[model samples]
Target chain A: MNKMQQRLLHPSKATRQDRFGKTISLICIGFIMILTVSIIGFIAIHGLATFFENHVSVMQFIFSSNWNPGQLGKNGQPQVGAFAMIVASFAVTLLAAILATPFAIAVALYMTELAPKRGAKMLQPVIELLVGIPSVVYGFIGLVVIVPAIRSVFGGTGFGILAGSIVLFVMILPTITSLTIDSLQQVPDHYRKASLALGATKWQTIYKVILRAALPGILTAIVFGMARAFGEALAVQMVIGNAALTPTSLTSPTATLTSQLTSQMGDTIMGTLPNNALWSLALVLLIMSVIFNLLIKVVGKRGEMKK
Target chain B: MTTNETVITTKDVRLYYGEHEALHGINLDFQKSQITALIGPSGCGKSTYLRCLNRMNDLIHDVTITGSFKIDGHDIYRPQQDVVSLRKKVGMVFQQPNPFPFSVYDNVAYGLRVQGIKDKKIISQKVEESLKQAAVWDEVKDDLTKNALSFSGGQQQRICIARLLAVKPDVILLDEPTSALDPISSAKIEEMLLQIKDQYTIIIVTHSMQQASRISDKTAFMLNGDLVEYGDTKKIFLNPEQEATSDYLNGKFG
Candidate 1:
């Protein structure tokens, strides 16, 4: 082969650089994957230890509200049932998502359709700022304002699922609104034009056409918000009044899985049943988040199929 | 042709997009139940003039329009004029086939539903009639529940036309509707337009001179936002009055 052909076939400096860049990115991705797998694996091993090694019944761990993991019950089983915390977590997450969805959709519509200029210049930054605010600040606000407000109005202790839901509603509102804005913006400009050219009123166009087309995207946004609400720890921990008891009313004291994990993780000894029980709670949270992610993917896929 | 009752009349219609003037004093009238073609080079404001007829330009920002646009002897630009009802009276089919990402049945019934017609029997009847009129009912009749976006481009365009026809508009403005389609699909659209021209006043913007000569009864040649020549399609295609029009037809310059 000629020297020119040899040089062309061999790796040049640019080709070498490209290989190096690819290797670097591959290494970074490998590191992230390893970290994610190890963390999940570690949590799963410890989480399962509570049931397998400690001889706790899986049914009792899930359905029983008796959560004294350090002690044994009359049945000689570890009292580590987490049914109350599970219920509390789902209740707060669902209520917060329901409360925030309408408000988020409304704000998103105003930003994208009604007053786009003012919405972009004035409201977008504000919503982004809300997102950037630390979760601790939200918790602090809830502890002082919402808890006291609920106390006066509803006439109870005010630190309960209701308080957590209200705080979560505020925290997830910006997330849902910003994501909803993105989905609404993803709707093609031609759709709006088509509806208007049909002689439909502005309200009808937005309501019937735009919203229906963006339905899957909007549902995905709400699921994302729900995921954030489900996994949030500190803000919900502060206001949920961590009692480890099954809540009978919105105003009664309750504890979520995350709150219990945060409050008790430090106190339990490593390798003990108490600590392993906390791991089980963590496992539940991890699984729920994975489900949320899967939900987003399914919704996104359905939206694409419609196109 | 001149004695026929006019469905749409525009006098001295000038449009500005921000600081840029797009349409300069366009004076034209479309005859009732006749096909009038607007032929021009790219960006000569044919689509802009078409949009003005239905007040579709109001959706754009920083657009200033002056002069009069009257449809069926009613001033459409009047402040108290209901733009929605005006648009209902004059429907539009766009350059791109834009059916809502919905079932065929829903897409065709959208206009009637918007008009607050709730009777299922009437909506189904209108949907079928319009789809047949647009010459696509035979292809899509069994699959009305299927998504409209799943169809081929030609079929989608026909469905869009069907969607427009369901409203029973008096005037139909087509803005280069066939410019994006294949020759076969374009032929189908031309045939469909000829079939429906007797019932609706049809104004079309076309880049294809052959299409203009083939389907249009009257053709208006526009150059740089000015109406250069307006006459019978046969006369315009056979013997032109203006040098620019002759040059454009003879492929001298766009």
Candidate 2:
């Protein structure tokens, strides 16, 4: 009788255990959100303070083609202009994304649609391995292999904007292609069937139905790949032929924001104008990354709504 | 639209999916401008035979077919035959409502666009005519640009039928087109089928005895992948000759 009464009072131990399980899940989610908020808050506070404290005009900071913030007026104070770095950085990233996107899409299509199943299974792992390699190694290879080859072809020293773009392109190809394949594969088979059933040829079905249906996903993949390429510093610095000015042509040396930071950070005084400029550039890069990430998220959300 | 006009004839048709036989040497004739119903339980191969009409099974892996099937005197399975052209002549509606993820108007115009008909006027006219024929024009006329996925299940099924009708195919295949709809929707589809039969030779696969008896002029009953009995719909339902057919229709056994 005593044991029966104890069982009734305890009921099941599972009730408390389930509550504990749910609590753990909430805690994990809260930790991630807190971490993201802390990082964003830190960047905004520190980065925004530098821009406001300098008393420099935002228009000159953005539109000026030269960044020489160290040499001052008749007083000989430091003056720096950041326009060259911003323009060169965007040019390099856009060129690389444009060069790589088509090849990535083609490779993804071949892997998912054209290759036999057995061959595809064998190749997928090897292609995915490209994403795991360190960026520094790719930089070294770009310095040795890609730079000299371009110099020979262009008939000059090849460490320039074109060389840097080529290296970034090669680095981002695998990311775009793999994501593209995933999106293409996610398109419903019914769309393909309906297209074919309407007397459209195989190529027609892919072009008209399958690709169109997955267009948002493909666009998101390209945006993510471009974001990765844009942020790549080590590889671009190794081959960009940093000349501290905006590039005039593919053969001319140029310095992106990352190269500028790498060049001026440790060698210069900690609180100098160049150092402050590096922080500003970092903030700009952060803003670009957030914007692109938001685009990817919105596109993904749209894909879900369609499904 | 003569009653004696024949649109498709299958002679000793046999179909296999990999190592398993799904249809075993079934002979049947589908009349032009009339509705023919193929009724059977699940796995009886009625759907498989419907797919055979347009060579849809060719899309599947490890599917083998051995038979003589003709649509307007053209052997569909012959090496020289083009499956695309054959399919254009014989449109199909699936068991599930599968309107393309497009605008309601675009769903009806998909067939014409694929056939390279670019005149907007012709497309709009045909879209309206097809939707009216499917009895969905009144519901969707105000929202032609809205996505087809926004429609109700019954509306989507009707939109699919409208899609099939826009191609002006000589024959249309329905694989339980209304099975996914509610009772009211199913009745609407049945009424539409009766109206469209005069212009298109229609072959329907159904499990409902009442639907078969109500709309079909000729009925074929299949069991265990074999055609057990086929005759006038009235005879098949009221006076089936084969014991298996009688037992199946009487609900004695599947």
Model 1 chain B weakest 10-residue run by lDDT: B1-10
TM-score of each: 0.98, 0.94
lDDT of 2: 0.85
The runs of at least 3 residues in candidate 2 whose Cα sits more than 4 Å from the true structure, single-residue gaps closed, are A1-12, A23-27, A73-78, A116-119
Residue B152: error of model 1 in Å? 0.8
lDDT string for model 1 (B1-254, tens) is: 45678888899989999989888898999998789999989999999999999999998899999989888888999999999999999999999999999999999999999999999999999999999999999999999999999999999999999999999999999999988899998999999999999899999999999999999999999988899999899999899999999999988887
How large is the interface RMSD of each prediction? 0.6, 1.1
* Candidate 2 residue-wise lDDT at A41: 79
Q: Which candidate is the best by DockQ?
A: 1
In candidate 1, stretches whose alpha carbon ends up further than 4 angstroms from where it belongs are: B1-3
> Taking the tens digit of each residue's C-alpha lDDT, what string does model 1 give over A1-307?
6999999889999999999999999999999999999999999999999989998888998899999998888988779999999999999999999999999999999999999999888988889898999999999999999999999999889999999999999999998998899989999999898888899999999999999999999999999999999999999999999999999999998999999999998999999999999999999999999999999999999999997
DockQ (0 to 1) for model 2: 0.68
In candidate 1, clashing pairs total: 0
